[model samples]
Target chain A: MRLAEAWRVALDALRANRLRSMLTMLGVIIGVAAVVALVAIGTGTKQQIENQVEGLGSNLLLVVPGRIQAGSAPTSSPLTLDDIDAINRVVGDRSRVAVTIASGETVRAGSRTGFASMQGVLETTPTVFVRNLDRGSYLTRTDVSTGRRVAVLGAGLARTLFADRDPIGRQITIGGVRFRVIGVFEPLGQSLGVDRDGEVHVPVTAAQRLLGTERIDGIAIRAPDRDRIGDLSTAVVAALTDRHPDTDFSAVTQEQILGVLGDILGVLTGVLAAIAGISLLVGGVGVSNIMLVSVRERTKEIGLRKAVGARPRDIGLQFLLEAVLLTTTGGILGMLLGGGTALLVDRLSPVPAALTWWSMALAFGVSAAVGIIFGVVPAQRAGRLDPVVALRTE
Target chain B: MTAAIVADDVSRTYQLDGVSVPALRGVSLTVDPGDYVAIVGTSGSGKSTLMHLLGGLDRPTGGTLLIGGRDVSTLSPDEMAALRNTTIGFVFQSFHLLARTTAQDNVGLPLVYRGVGRRERRERAATMLERVGLAHRITHRPNQMSGGEQQRVAIARALVTGPSVLLADEPTGNLDSATGQSVLALLESLVDDGVAVVLVTHDRDVAARARRQIVMKDGLISETR
Candidate 1:
């Protein structure tokens, strides 16, 4: 028989038992949908994290004391301004090197008070990082050199302390010491789970005096070009290691961070797809069972067809076609459903989701395979039926 | 021209739970085009077995059976099916029409195996249905039709491929006497068109109407007249 006729016959058979066909298809529908939606969510999160990591800065490297591997302890040798000067000499550009010493402190302006993360930074912070000023000027070299008490309020902190009033040149007390605000930074929502707009920046020298600490948290360096980042990292890590021979310094780039994070998220996506595949397996079993029942029910029909002229091959082809048709239809519906769910999630929720063509293709391919794998035994049984015996069935 | 079907000393022994039981023991028969013959017997007397063998649904285990001049033992299962498609048509006692399909599609089924195109198959099926006096009921499913009409539809389905031989097994058994007469008349009408008609029946009245009769006793033919 022609393939088209086989398909028509299969379709007619399915239509004859529309309710049973639909119920049998439901399992595959849910399985394919779950795979598409879950994979979308996983990939979307990976993309979101990548964007945030890249948003930190271009051609940037973060140097932290001690190894950044799992279960590593902090080094006893803290990063000092002398170490910064040593790195500055090697880098040949003072503006590309910056460091920060962080402390959480409460600030007061008049009767208003708010807690904020206080970051002691140098004049070169704005150049080394991606921060932009909304009003007034950022810290100057003279401010850091003279130990002048000056601060830059973040967008959120400025709103809290001064509200409608201008925050630049306003006085705010930090740890019982007063400093004049020199600038207000533009709003930066969040990056790497840190609230950028909730920080207050001060001159490192003045901050050291207020906090009574000389230890620095970390160093940020901007390479001259993208390709030089690796070379520059090696140089800076060597310089820091030279000063503190007992400690190991690690310089991490954005790509390294993204690679590690992408690995974790990729595994998570695979696991979710695997879990969804279990349901597809179950659906395939259901298809096999239903097809067996259909074969049993149509034994007399098989006998009649054989008596008329149908070959065993034709009978087998018809049944196999029926199974493939069932699953492929279910697969298509599930794709629409999964794509719709992904679209809905992307729009209505904070959790990101994106559908890829490959995932859709994979789900479709698997569904068709499910049909073939589950269809074989029943189709063979129908083909191998003894016509005389089958005709004897009522 | 070759006979439509020729069986020479054919025998069929079936295995039931590893024990052999002979259904047809050395029965020989010859049917020519335009012939009308009937095989009559009580249940389990091997008339059905002979019909099945002549239809090419089962091969004879002993002796030679030729359908369309090809020996039954020489044909593969697929070749046997192809021979049946081109040379033989079947009508069952219970009207074995697909329950959910229209009369037209059910009639077109044999052509489907012959690789006939859909449109041509439908046209031929309609023509055959009309020939069986079911022109107005072409679209009706079997369940919607009366017993007589369903048997006519089955006759239409059997004859749709324009085969050389038509095999009817108790074709009128399920119908009322009046309806059975009409169905039997339809089968007789096809023999005039040079198609051999072979009928298996237990009804003496039905057997009397045929041009030839073979009565079987046990697994062998007891009489031919």
Candidate 2:
């Protein structure tokens, strides 16, 4: 028989048992939808991380003491202010260099107390990183030279300590030492999993005296241009290594961090798709089971068709087409459902979700393959039935 | 003209549980165009088996059985199916019309296997339904029609392929006497149009109306007239 005619007969058969057909398709629907939505969420998280990393600052490089490879415990930093001055000479632009000595400390203005990430930094911090002040002036050369007890409060910390009152020029104590708030930073939300607006910046000199430590945690440098980052990183690492012959320093660019993160998330997306594909496998089994029942139920009809000169292949083709029709239609509905869910989650939540074309195509192709793989046995059974015996069945 | 079907010393043996059961043993028969032949037998008399062989639904285990001059034993299953499509039509006692299908679509089924297009299949089915006096009932499903009308639809389906032979296995078995008479009259009318008619029946009166009679006893023909 012609394929079109076979398709019509298959469609007619499915329509005859509407509820059963729909129930059979449900398994496939859930499977495809899960695959699409999960993959979208995974991809979106990866993209979000990439954006935050790039948004840190253009042509940025971070130099940290000790090795940065996996499974290594952090060693005590030997980096000092002298190392920063030496690296400043190598970059030829002192404004491009910055350093931080980070400590968790509690700060208080009157009875209002708030915990903040205390970032001991130089005046060049705003120039090296993407940060801005909302009010008052930032620290200057004399602040680090003379160890001035002046501070800048993060936007969230400023709000918590002073409420509506102006925070600039107010007295706050960090690590139980009295300091004046010289400026309040603009509101910068979470980036690279850190709350930028909940930090306090002071001169490295005062932070060392207060915390009783001369070592710096890390160094940040902004390249003059994107192309100069490689040369600048080599120079900074060499300069730091020259000072501390017994210590190791690694200088990493933003792109390397993104690449590693992207690799990890890519695998995560694939794993999610694979887990969802298990449901599709179960759905295929359901299709096969229903098709078997249909074949058994329509034994006499099969006999009739065979008697009417339908070839064995024709009978097999009809049943196979019915199975494919069920899954393909189910796949389309699942795509819409999944796409809608991804869209809703993207719009309504902070969790990122991006629907990729390849994921949709992969889901669709796998569902179709599921139909064919499970459809073969039942169609064969129908084709191989003895016409005389089948016709005798009630 | 070639006989529509010819069987010479044909035998059919069925295997059941590793034991051979002979359904038709060394039986021979011939049916010609415009002939009306009725086969009468009780259950297990092999008349049904003989009919199945003549319709090309099964091959005889021994000897030659030909439908439309093609030897059944030599033909593959698919080739036999093709031959049956071109040369034979069948009407069952139960009026095995597809339920929930209109009379026109039911009648067009055989043509579908013949690879006929939908428009032409519909046109031909409608014409054949009219020939069976079911023209007015063309749109009615089998469940919506009376037994006699459903049988008429089956008959229309059988004849739609323009086969040379019509095989009816107790075509009127499910109908009332009046309705059975009308359906029998429809089969007899096809003989007048030069088609060969072969029927298997248990009713003696139904057997008596045919131009020729063959009475089967056991697995072989016991008498013929």
Candidate 3:
């Protein structure tokens, strides 16, 4: 028989029992939907993390003090400004490298008070850290040299302290010292577990004096190009070790952190996808069960067709087409439902959930394969039915 | 031309729970084109078994059965199916019309298995329904029509493929006496049109309508008149 006729016959049979067909398709729908939704969430989170990592300035390295060993006594030695200068000297021309330091503190403005992070930076901090000002101006070389008491508020901090009012020129107290807000930083959103929009920036000298410390917390260095970041990191470590032999500090390149994070997230995504695949297997078994019942119920119909000169292959093909149609249709409906859910998640939460073409294709391919794999036994049973016995059944 | 149907010492045995029971005991018969033959017997006398074998619905365990001169036992399953499609047609006691399907589509079913295109299949089905005097009821489903009308649709479906012989097992068993007479008259007309007809039944009055009558007793042919 022609394929079109077989398709028509299958359609008629399904339509005759609409409720049963829909019930049989429910398993496939849930299976495909779960796979698509979970995979979309996984891929979306990976992309979000990659974008945040890339948002940090290119060709950058961080230097921080190492913890004391278990048996060793605590050391009061911390990285200082002199260490930054010595690293610059060892890394070649000063123009090709720059460094900034930061410390966490609480700041208050009149009736409003909140915990905030404070950064002690040089004139080139904005360029090296890829920060931009929303209004007013960045600190200059004289601000650090003269120890000026000027500060820049991050966007979130400004909003919390002043509401909708402009924060430039307003006075804010940090660690019990009053300073004028010279500028407000543009919105940067969250990155690397730090809220970039909720920080306060001041000159290194003013921060050192106000916080009662000449020791720096940590240093961020920018290389002239990506290719030179490795060499610059090695040089920074050598210079810091030479300057403070008794102090333990570590310098880490950006790629090392990204590589570790990618590995962890990749495993997490794989586990989630595997869990979703289990539901698809269950759905395939449901399809097989329903197909077997349909074959049993249609035995007389099979006999009638056989008597009318239909070959065994034709009977098998008709049933197989019915099974495939059920699954592929369910798969399409599931995709729509999953895509809608992902869009809703992206809107309602900070985590992004995006559906990709390849994931959709994979879900569809798996559904079709599931249909064929589960459909074969029932179709063969219908084909191998004894016509005489089947006709005698009714 | 060769006979439309030739059965030479054909036998069929059924195994029920591993116990062998013979259904047809080496019965031989020949039917020619344009012949209206009826096989009459009581229940369990193997009349239905012989009809099934003649229609290629089953294979005899011993001896040979041929339809349109093609040996049935030698033909593969696929070839037997093709032979049934081209040479023989069947009408059943239950009228076997698919419920919820229009008469036109039900009549076109045999041609569908023959791979006929959609438009031609419909045209041939319509023509056959017209010949069976059900032209106006082509769009009606089986349940929408009377028992006699449904049987007419089955007859139309049987004749749509233009086969050489028609095998009908109790074709008028479910109809009233008046309706059964009309159906037998239609089959008589078909035999007059040069298509051989084989009718199986237990009703002596029904068998009396045919030109030849064969009687069966305990899986063996007892008489022919």
> What are the root-mean-square deviations of the candidates from the true structure over C-alphas?
2.2, 1.7, 3.1
Per-residue alpha-carbon lDDT of candidate 3 for residues A192-271, written as tens digits (9 for 90 to 100): 77899988889988988886788876777888788988887777877888877887777777787777778888788778
lDDT of 2: 0.92
Per-residue alpha-carbon lDDT of model 1 for A176-230, expressed as tens digits?
7899998999999877789889899999988888888787879999899989998
Q: Give the C-alpha miss distance for residue B20 in model 1, angstroms.
A: 2.2
Candidate 3 to truth, TM? 0.92
Q: Assess candidate 1 and give its TM-score to the true structure.
A: 0.95
lDDT of 1 at B186: 89
| Candidate 2 deviant stretches above 4 angstroms | A134-137
Fnat for candidate 2 (0 to 1): 0.57
Interface RMSD in angstroms for candidate 1: 0.7
Question: Which one wins on DockQ?
Answer: 1
Per-residue lDDT of B13-86 in model 2, one digit per residue for the tens? Answer: 99999999999999989999999999999999999999889998898999998899988888988998898888
Per-prediction TM-score to the true structure, in the order listed: 0.95, 0.97, 0.92
lDDT of 2 by residue, A1-394 (tens): 9999999999999999999999999999988999999999999999899888987788899999988999999889999898888998999888999999999999989999999999889999988888889999898989988999999989999999999999988999998999999999999889878998899999999999999989999999999888999999988898888889999999999989988889999899889989998998899999999999999999999988888898899999999999999988888888888888998999999989999999899888988888887888999999988888788889
First chain of candidate 3, TM-score:
0.89
Best-fitting candidate, measured by TM-score?
Answer: 2
